[model samples]
Target: MNPALANRPGQHLRIAALLCTLLLSLLGAGARAELQLLDGIAAIVNDDVVMLSELRAETEMIYQQLLRTQNQAPPRDALAGQVLERLILDKLQLAIAQRAGAQISESELDQAVAQVAEGQGLSVEQLFAQAAADGLSRDWVRDKIRNEVIIGRVQQSIVNRRITISDQEIDNFLNTNSSELLNAEELQIGHLMLPLSSGTDEQTIAATREKAEALREQILQGADFRQLAVLHSSGQNALQGGDLGWRAANQLPTAFAIALRDLEPGQVTAPIRTDA
Candidate 1:
């Protein structure tokens, strides 16, 4: 058995699960705009309404987060599609939790936040500071963490429990990836990005540059980075305030390394350019 799986609470969080089976079916071309409803219906998952706003926010969040961490522009259509699908699956799981009379509690949410902090190798204070840089409030992060946990529990109750992974599969994974996996150290990071795109027209180029400069000013002025990112960033994790949680340096791109070298804790960069 996977050690992590063995170590989990007797009850797992199923509601937070992102089911592989459902991810492809729910999303469409990854447009930056929210998903529109056809005659006032976005999409039906079992019995739920996924508003365009929710879909858009989640997609933008994923996009911004990906760009900041990966340091590469994702194919918008593909990523958006996948994100939308994940949100729908999440909605489905959330609904199931509701049906089962499951409700999240404040203590549970707090525990989730603590779990996230511990995983990141941060003290609660450090986690809050990082979260702030990403423009996320402690409450929001806690709620998000809680949602994921609940979803995971719900998924396990319904689906994961039903599926069985063979020992051979585990053995194969260990054989192929054990050395690097065992040696890896995880780091949780909160990232925010302001993307400056080159313009076709000189005026447009100037305007984009102005926007980037303004974004930097906002950060300097104590404006919330994640909120601004959510509102203005062209990257994916805008909704989550450009948070790219714990990851190894190898998973990040070269440009990110350069950017990180100059950034002090709690400082935001002026502007960075990338080819889309």
Candidate 2:
């Protein structure tokens, strides 16, 4: 080592020691906080236990997601009543699922996780990385998926065998709700979106447009469009393979209805954008 550099090192060594101590303190505090959060179960539904921290975490996730969807600032107490109702419902369903001994296998959980990733146009690894980045454990996502599958299976078992959507019921409902439901169509179509924004630098816009065009080209090259939609579409129906289920033509935005009218099954179209 250079003699001058070696002589000046004590200050840096002290700073490094201080930083290590601070880091350890922060870690200790974080662990303590986590222990406090899960110290006890806040509620019991039948044989199932609901931890307070788990309920708060889930409620916060749902609330934040709803806020983003609405593109509005969420009220501090926004829909407090509704949120409580949902939590109660969730508890009831979870209890029922536990009683039925409904279980989700790792394979099933993986498939559900894959579907969520595909819906967001992400690979499973990427999705897991994102969850980690969000300060969420991969196990948390898996447990959520497990509960979803169990509850869904239980609900379906209860309803599917006894309840039916008959053609007669559909016809009767359509007649009774003619103004709201008649003259509607469900379009089965796919698209690639490229947004134009003045705030975006020209180079970024061009690159985004290029990616969008490439996606469209791949779609036309016999790449499964539904699979692609499950992976990449940004529209509301992205999770459902871009399926905009049947609704009255007049109920949709005028521009969207026009586009729907112009589309045909198994046909692809150039990108279209408009405000609703």
Writing each residue's lDDT as its tens digit, candidate 1 over 1-276 gives: 788867875535553344433554344433323454333445677767877655655566566555664554455555565566667777888888888887778887777778878976888888888767656677766766777888878867876667687999689776776678666555555555544455477777678788878878988998766655555554444446567777775455556656666566787655666554
Global fold similarity of model 2 (TM-score): 0.45
TM-score of each: 0.40, 0.45
Cα lDDT for residue 190, model 2?
49
Q: Rate the local accuracy (lDDT) of all candidates.
A: 0.65, 0.65
Q: Kindly list the per-residue Cα lDDT of model 2 for residues 127-159, writing each as its tens digit.
A: 778667656688987887787778778878987
RMSD to native for every prediction? 24.5, 16.3
Best by TM-score: 2
Count of clashes in candidate 1: 29
Residue-pair clashes per prediction, in order, are 29, 2
